[model samples]
Target: MSTYMAFVYGILYLLFTTFTFVFEDAYGFTQSNVGLVYIGIGVGMLLGLAVLGSASDKIAIGMAKSHNNGVIKPEYRLPALVPGGFFVPVGLFLYGWAAEKHVQWAVPLLGTLLVGIGIIVSFMCVQTYLVDAFTVHAASAIAANTVLRSVFGAVLPLAGLKMYSKLGLGWGNSLLGFLALAMCVVPFFFVRYGERIRTNPRFQVKL
Candidate 1:
């Protein structure tokens, strides 16, 4: 689940990194203007972090208080993904189709902001979930997640230009959005069945 979260995050970030080029080529924004436009996503990310990062813990604590005699389970952190899952695909499609159609610049920028918020929200939940689940081996789990995500982050952008060229930004980003949409199932599955999966002897950490 952590790795899958990372993969989705990697792709979202790749889109962000390449957004400057899109602004210039599609919207004819000057380089200076493009830099300014980036502030939208940056601000959006910070907002998401501020809001959702702390909310994950609060939500978990609240859940614990309600059930399990106040002993928090890792799965409690996963509910944050529900909102994020909805935002990401919506943002992606908004940005993609808006850019391809040459809509107002603010429209695409708004989409970028939504994507940024979605990324941070989902990322915080996944990070907290991994740590909560792995406990003694949390560091190792995080390392593996980082490596896989970094690999995807590095490789996916390499194809960005080709994808946009062939399909145009609309369909290209739609493809990425579709993938993110599919991944929404991942967290839901874990929330429902993670305890059983984690209880398997194979997942236990040896001292």
Candidate 2:
């Protein structure tokens, strides 16, 4: 779950920084105003972390307790992830097509809203699942995931500008959006069978 969340957010960090200007130009906003548009997503992300991040832990705990079979089903943590997974690509498509046609500013902004909310929800889901799954080694799991995701995050951003420029906003982001859509299935699969995966004796031991 944490791994899935990391990859999703890794894509988001790439999209937000890369695509904001693309939308802004569509709306005919100045560079500074475009910066502000991304600020909205920034503000949204901060608010989401504050409110939903810890709530996911509480929700997970309740679901885990309800299992009553002495085993905490990891799938319980996946519900919140569903919304995030759906919204990320939806937002990307909306933002991409809107910018391509130069639609109303709000159209692209709506896409940003979906993206911001999705990222936060997914981030919380991933973090909480990791904490519960590897209680004793949660920090280490997070550290490792963070390192790899960061490399992708860094490399993707560098390439994003060139991609958007060459393909144009619609195709470039749509291509990325499709990739996100494919990755969205990962959490669902994990949720359905994560218990079985974790049951392996190898996973029982902490790294």
Query: Which residue pairs does candidate 2 place in steric collision?
Result: none
**lDDT values for all models:** 0.83, 0.73
Model 2 compared with the native: what TM-score?
Answer: 0.85
Give a tens-digit lDDT track for model 1, residues 82-163. 7776778888899899989989999988888888888788778888888989998899989998888888888878888888
Question: What TM value does model 1 have?
Answer: 0.94
For model 1, how many clashes?
0
Error of 2 at 53 (Å): 4.5
Q: Model 2: residues >4 Å from true position, as ranges?
A: 17-20, 46-58, 69-74
Q: Estimate, for each residue in 162-206, the C-alpha lDDT of model 2 and write its tens digit.
A: 888899878987887898788888888878777788788876885
